[model samples]
Target: MALKRKKAYESNIEKINGARMTIETQMMAIENANVNLETMGAMRAGAEAMKNIHGSMNIDKVDETMDDIRDQMDIANEISEAISRPVGVGDDLDEDELLNELEELEQEELDAKMLETPSPVVTAPNVPVHVPAARANEVEDDEEAELRALQASMAM
Candidate 1:
């Protein structure tokens, strides 16, 4: 009876482990699907932007926009590939490595975006700018006059 009980217990453990693996695989599949959908969305947006540019719109900004879309596609591709591979399938395929690569890709995309958007040159305001010494002298004269008046009032 004890032998039968032990066999049943071991079988249940195996079943639980199998279920866990299946769940993990399904989650990965869902993640891949989401990434693909996002890629499609990015591609659609890029196409629409291109169409607008073709319709006589000044599309100087379209290059950067397209590059951004391309970056998104790259990310989607990376994610899909990562998820499609079975977990722990390769010696170099750890979760940390995958996450680090994704982070690096994201940072690269940010850097590209920063490079694409030119900073607006801020010109100084045209207001009458006075030298600081001149302003300070004016303030000092006012303070002296105020002090003299106070002294005179106290004397009275």
Candidate 2:
């Protein structure tokens, strides 16, 4: 009876060991499948990135846009130079005519100013002098008269 009971316990231990081995093998296969799925997802993402890179760039359009930008920059530079240059800085002019006109205008302004200014009234000086009635007819001749006129002008 003891030998039969020992044999039955040994058989039961073997069955549990076999079941544990089978479960371990199945878990290993599941882990391997998950790793393969992750690898495939990485490869798909890489493929999508490559496709987007190829779609986004065009060599001919890029070159044309660069050339157009360079041409526009040249035009802008020319326009800026044209706008910055001084006007009437290098043309020939008639200086003599301009000076004559300036002088005429100055003379006219001086004449206008002289007309606007106030001047004192002209009157004879209040000098006391008496001449005899008979001698008043005797006028001084040209030489003495001219001398007196010159003296009067100098005194004035």
Candidate 3:
């Protein structure tokens, strides 16, 4: 009787395990279906956006706008070049004559400055000035004494 009861319990455990495996499989299938539905929804939204964008703009209009922008840029570049060009490039002026004229103008300015009257000078008050004593006589005396002392020391 004990052996029959043990066999029955083993059989029940096996059945329960099989049912758990089936439930897990069904759950995984439901999750996969949900992911598939979300992916389809995102794809549909992207398609609608693309259709709206295409409907708003034509290829010819885009090309014409780009061409106009390019033409404006070229015109701007030409105007810039014209403005930056050096002035007097085609003039026929003599460099020697210009230099002589500049020298004459400078000489005329110097002559005019020299002919102007000088400013009046300011005179100081009369006062007795104190003069410093001469140090040359002291230096001569020191040199003579130093030579005599050095000669005497050397002789000793």
Candidate 4:
């Protein structure tokens, strides 16, 4: 009886272990399918984006735009070179002759200024003038006579 009971207990334990393993395998399969579904969705979205991008532009248009940019750069470079060159058509200029002409004109102006006549001097009417020593005695005598006459009139 003890042996039979032991065998029955062992059989029940084996059945329980097998059921646990089956449940674990089914969970793993479900997880794998879920991951595959998510990957497919991501791939579909990427394909759509790439298709849209390709539809918008082509290789020929890109090449043409690049060519236009290159041509514009060349034209700009030529214009810059033309602007930097000297303006005259091979004309020679003499620096010494120009300096000599400028010096002569300045000398002529200085000579004209020196030749101008000076203006006359002007004096105020009330200011006194210097007289000779002989004339100064006669002026004093006349001043004394006038003073005496003024005194006689004041007395009357």
The RMSD of every model to the true structure, in order and in angstroms, is 34.3, 25.0, 12.5, 23.1
Per-model lDDT: 0.93, 0.89, 0.90, 0.91
Of candidate 4, the 10-residue stretch with the lowest lDDT total is: 89-98
Judging by lDDT against the true structure, name the best candidate. Answer: 1
Runs off by more than 4 Å, candidate 4:
79-156
lDDT of 2 by residue, 1-156 (tens): 889999899898899899999999999999999999999999999999988987877899899999999999999999998888789863465889889999999999999999999999889989767776555545445567889999999998
Q: TM-scores across all candidates?
A: 0.35, 0.36, 0.50, 0.46
**TM-score (C-alpha) between model 4 and the true structure:** 0.46
> If both were scored by TM-score, which would come out higher, candidate 2 or candidate 3?
3
Q: Considering summed lDDT, which 10 consecutive residues are worst modelled in model 1?
A: 55-64
How does residue 91 of candidate 4 score in lDDT?
A: 47
For candidate 4, give the lDDT of residue 151: 100
Give me the candidate number with maximum TM-score: 3
Give the runs in model 1 whose Cα sits over 4 Å from its true position: 57-156
Supply every candidate's count of residue pairs whose N, Cα or C atoms clash at under 3 angstroms.
Answer: 0, 0, 0, 0
Instruction: Rank candidates by TM-score, best first.
Output: 3, 4, 2, 1
Whole-structure CA lDDT of model 1 = 0.93
What does the lDDT come to for candidate 4? 0.91
Q: Report the alpha-carbon TM-score of model 3 versus the true structure.
A: 0.50
